[model samples]
Target: MSVRLQLTDIKKTYRAVTALNSVSLDMMGGKIIVLLGANGAGKSTLMRILAGLEDPDSGTIQFNNQTTDAKSIRRVSTLVFQKSVMFSLSVYGNLAYGLKIRGVPEGEISKRIAEALEAVRLSGFEKRRAKKLSGGEQQRVALARAFLLNSNVLLLDEPTANLDPNSAAIIEKAILAKKSSSRIIIMATHNLNQARRMADEIVHIHNGEIVEASAPEDFFENPKSEVTRKFINGELDF
Candidate 1:
């Protein structure tokens, strides 16, 4: 019953700059795959392509044994950006928007919103304007919004960046709570510590290519590449 995703020979370019170079990965069911990279290392570009925000110049994507298009990919997968955005609406409104678009009934929408807010530990803030929340609070709300959507696949980019310890912990709890055998989570981040805590597998990208992919323990404690070693040693910036 495991879900599976496969990308073969993926490539992307921006004018003369290659953002991804024949990258390929095979991922399956209910595991966290953390993408690590320095700045401009193509982590975001790879995530965006997977999220269907941008098309790979050349590639094939197969999810659950079926090839799919961007719209179809997005229907079952959701992405939360590094800079979270909330509409000029109440928290309840923001959370309910996607459900409404998907034609969920009003009763179900209310129930999901309540559950999502509780999951994110913002149970009493539905009536508050989303934009009025603090950065951490806003990110949590964004996360709650994604949870309410209940997509089978989720992608998060720098989800806890710049947050205080408490807020990050809360967000981490929400993420862990959402993990299930029926879902797949792919996250891109620069936080080595967070990656260590959250990742089942770590994929290291450098110069738009995946240089290393391994289990977290092996990746962190016994990296195989000089680049991965340098990264763990804090010798590389970006």
Candidate 2:
């Protein structure tokens, strides 16, 4: 797969706390790279920076062979937060808002919405009030919304966190279904098992620094770092 994004010496700090420290990695298209870390281990921070929701204190973000602005970056990437945010609109409205803003034709919008909802298994939910849906349903809607954009990169922060097993399974299926050769998916998760299921590559972060990066098989069977081993064995607490 080609490199979709490159982060060089990325750093982010909040007051005295450093959220990332000289981090650098190349993200390739057509694969799911799971960021494995406990809470506050900088997974969310890294994802936020990638999504252009937050800027790094120091670093350069390169995309499509050029340094890009946040607007340009965000234009081709979409972030789904752990806590779903739905505008006070129906599911169709929520899904259509971004396309509408881009002035997509109504017929194309309808086609994309149908495909996205089907991908997320929410075919009959278009008229439901987004805010009135259950947490799991809302999360699925969020996934559908992102799928509609068909962005080059998809950034998900704890996509299945606090979800029931069935809900989590649905989200996982949606994620897998949405994969394409032109798209890159990066997901943050504390669950080792989920990472094993979804990740082609596993990136381990601890105390705001990346300690190990490897394929899922190697990461699970032959972890190179003490921190990674501890995390896999459930010895470390978030």
Candidate 2's C-alpha runs over 4 A off are 1-3
Residue-level lDDT of model 2, residues 51-168, one tens digit each, is: 8888899989988668976778888899999999999999999999999998999999988998888887788888999999999989999998988888898999999999999999
Task: Choose the strongest candidate by TM-score.
Answer: 1
Residue-level error in angstroms, candidate 2, position 122: 1.0
For each candidate, give its TM-score against the true structure.
Answer: 0.97, 0.96
User: CA lDDT, every prediction?
Assistant: 0.90, 0.90
